[model samples]
Target: MSHITETLNQRGNRYGEFNRHAEITQNIKKAMQDSPNWATLKPWHREGLEMIAHKIGRILNGDPNYDDSWHDIAGYAQLVEQIVRPPAPPVPPAVPMQNPMRGAL
Candidate 1:
């Protein structure tokens, strides 16, 4: 076999995992949909979405940067975190005031 053919076969072996990238993208979308609010997505949320798109594009184009063994979906995780609410602030609850006229009734 030609050296070129050998290299191509090895490279093609990694393409099988391309679908995983698509799966990650789908999960990201689902997370976004499940979010209660869309108006207040943080900057990192947008960045993660853009990064996911870039990663998918890179994988589809056979970019050499993609790792075949490691399915790193940090972008998806970050986006989901943004979709979820931040931790609530700790504060004392306010008690409702009872109407004074109720005693007279």
Candidate 2:
């Protein structure tokens, strides 16, 4: 997921340009080899790790892309959109100690 996070961050900075998941996966594999802690990542987590790496790559390389292409990438672009262009109004914070079944309409 770190890879995904990194890719997402890059995508936001670059304003969405590239979508190289394979290269991202390679980076993630290298990262895992370098850091022993990466062994704990589950199989599912490893699934889209490349996508995340793409984001990191963009960040490292600096966002050279324009804003128009940001929405074009496949795989978790919506999450990227949220980071780049946040919703108009953030959802209201939940009330403390709110009963789960209180609103029995």
Candidate 3:
């Protein structure tokens, strides 16, 4: 076999598990997109979720003990969370109401 062919075969072999997990991940993503909240997500948030979902597939597909895969999911989520929605207007504190009975007593 040619060197190029050998390398390609190895790469394909590596992807065998990935291919199965990826199809499952795609279905997961589709379900997420179907939810009403999907429209509210920023593109960055959605992308992060997609990447995290892929990691989840890896974890669930006979590799639940893999630490880095879990970390990768957290890392992706953190990246999106770091720049999540714009700041909300600061809420004003309520003024204490003076009771009329206080002075009348």
Candidate 4:
């Protein structure tokens, strides 16, 4: 087997546990669905990302308990990408300008 394939398999095995965690998956979905608007979603996403960052900082500072930060980070990143997708904008109708020189000096 190639090095890349081995690394991928290892990561897949490690991260696959998160998929099997019903509570985590449900909570992620609930948090995502509870946000009413993009304004609210942005803050929630930022908070999750910040949490992951904090976890990383702790691990870097020698906190072994934060080793599972990758799972949280991946979850949050996936939520942001998957659930926070905005709806398509409504197309505005084109209107002909009555005053062609409206902005002329």
Writing each residue's lDDT as its tens digit, candidate 1 over 1-105 gives: 999988766755654344665676666666765778644777767666656654554465455466732244564765568577687789889999999899695
In model 3, state the lDDT of residue 42: 82
True-structure lDDT of candidate 3 = 0.79
Of 1 and 4, the candidate ranking higher by lDDT: 1
- Candidate 2 lDDT by residue in tens digits, 8-57: 77755654434554455467668865786657865545444545565455
How displaced is residue 59 in candidate 4, in Å? 2.0
Worst 10 residues of 3 by lDDT: 9-18
**lDDT for each candidate structure:** 0.61, 0.55, 0.79, 0.58
Please give the ranking of all candidate structures by lDDT, highest first, separated by commas.
3, 1, 4, 2
TM-score (all chains, Cα) for each model: 0.32, 0.31, 0.63, 0.34
Q: Candidate 2 has what TM-score? A: 0.31
Model 4: clashing residue pairs? none
In candidate 3, which residue ranges exceed 4 Å CA deviation? 1-16, 85-105
lDDT of 2 at 88: 92
Q: After superposition, how far is residue 37 of candidate 2 from its true place, in Å?
A: 3.3
Model 1 lDDT on a 0 to 1 scale: 0.61
Pick by lDDT: which candidate is best?
Answer: 3
